[model samples]
Target: MLELHLNFCNLVEIPDAIGNLHFLEILNLMGNNFSTLPSLKELSKLQLLNLKDCRQLKYLPNLPSRTDLSSKRSLPESFSSKKDPWAFERFYDYMEAGLNTFGCPELIELERCTSTALSWTLQILLQVHYQYILPSLWNIPFPSIISSIIGGSEIPSWFNNHREGMGSIITIDESPLMHKGNNCIALACCVVFGPPASRRKAPPIIHSLNHVSVPFLCAEDRITEDHLWWFYVTSGSHIWSTKYENLKLQFHIIRESDIESWSFHGKKYGYRWVYEKDLEESNLTMICSR
Candidate 1:
């Protein structure tokens, strides 16, 4: 019964020696610097793996034959792919329509957004191992899911709209806002790898309000509130200015001055930044409500 708690140590890589802990039951390696995970095929008794902010990690290794992969349950839909036998082809088609030109933008914009989104997804799965497996393992393998989501297969309609809108306006090029004020654009994409929720609400709203100014973008009125939230704001962006109605929030902001260079981790790619603001606001409510 070997239990490991290696949280928040800023480790850059998983040691191959971890495979020796065959009796290991729990491993909490959250908040580390590890970009890739060590092989766990030898640890048949392993149970829980917590990798909350191992942001550097990009890919997961193949699991042992008996390992249950669905423990985390809420795998992002984007990770679902067609190449797999369980590939939700219909779902993929719908998502593609939602994000593609027939679905959202012109061909160029669709391609660009899809490419960037896929790149990010691959980067996340490169170094880790599937901690848990879903009861209903998709005929498709995990690697395929990573490829589909990142490559630009259709996602939920909300995501398509959000991606299209953002792709139309934002470019990878440095923005003026980054130079004048402390601001950067962070793009996040998650692919639920489990069963769909029975009663899911619309996707969260992505908002970017000029932090330096006032008048606050009300939650109900903000354009991003209804669809997949993809926000691009400067360092001056603020959430307090908006009206919130009981939502769990997590955010990370990176500015132009902060980034040093682009690098690769596993199949994923990452850009290093000098500064980043990461925050998680739980049970968020509007100030007016109070």
Candidate 2:
């Protein structure tokens, strides 16, 4: 079979023989009860593997090189990639395939998993990006979306170049690492949105505006009651002059009711704002082409 979905079947174990399906492109085993998965190295064509909400799953096999593996609520410290860190890197490499560990709570010992496990996962993501020199997503040619938004109102402590609590404008100074000459420029912007707190009869509708002089593709998502919005954007522009030598990026989150006061001066913009913690790891990485 080219595609197989056995999600939430209350399955405890899968036979090893399933791996013989060499043509499988998508294998979905989400919401199952299994603790470990059988190796399917033979499935070379496998592209998308969804193990979301597999709370009991404690292990993930080394999927194909291009495989996009996504698992949320996979709270176990199951990524034993001491031999191959690539196994863990693939999880966040595909920006289109979100790794949503938000709202996934579990207990390992006396500590809450949201803090401990999530920390480990983000660390690995940063390490992979640093070691492997993260490749570009197929949709964009330069300045890949190599960032992620964890499910929390507050930004993580490890974040770099960040401002804390309220207000929308953020400035990123030009880094020496960025190549000179703006032949092509891109921003790996990630913003995490949490449920807005409102005490009135109606809850506030949150929105983030991008008021920068850059070419960015904007995508709008339906805002539900308590969903964490994951925003990753890749932008490239040559029209920018050397006037922006410092490159101060503005990221903001505002309420829907306040959109009337905001001016849309024809700049390419998107909704939602980034929680500021200045994750030095999560920088406004600019791809300045030489």
Write down the TM-score of every candidate: 0.28, 0.39
Residues 1-290 of candidate 1: C-alpha lDDT, one tens digit per residue:
45677867878877799878766644667567665667765665443444544555554432232332222223345534434532443232211111101111112343344433333222222211222223244532222222222222334332222223221112222333343324222322322111122323223334442111101111212111111222222222242233433212332211112211111111111121111232111111111112
Give me the runs in candidate 2 sitting further than 4 Å from their true place: 18-20, 40-44, 66-95, 98-186, 189-232, 235-290
lDDT of 2 by residue, 44-100 (tens): 555445655566655455343333222221222343446555434333333222233
* Superposition TM-score, candidate 1 onto the true structure: 0.28
Best by lDDT: 2
Residue 19 miss distance in model 2 (angstroms): 4.1
- How many clashing pairs in candidate 2? 9
Candidate lDDT values, in order: 0.31, 0.37
Which window of 10 residues has the lowest lDDT sum in candidate 2? 213-222
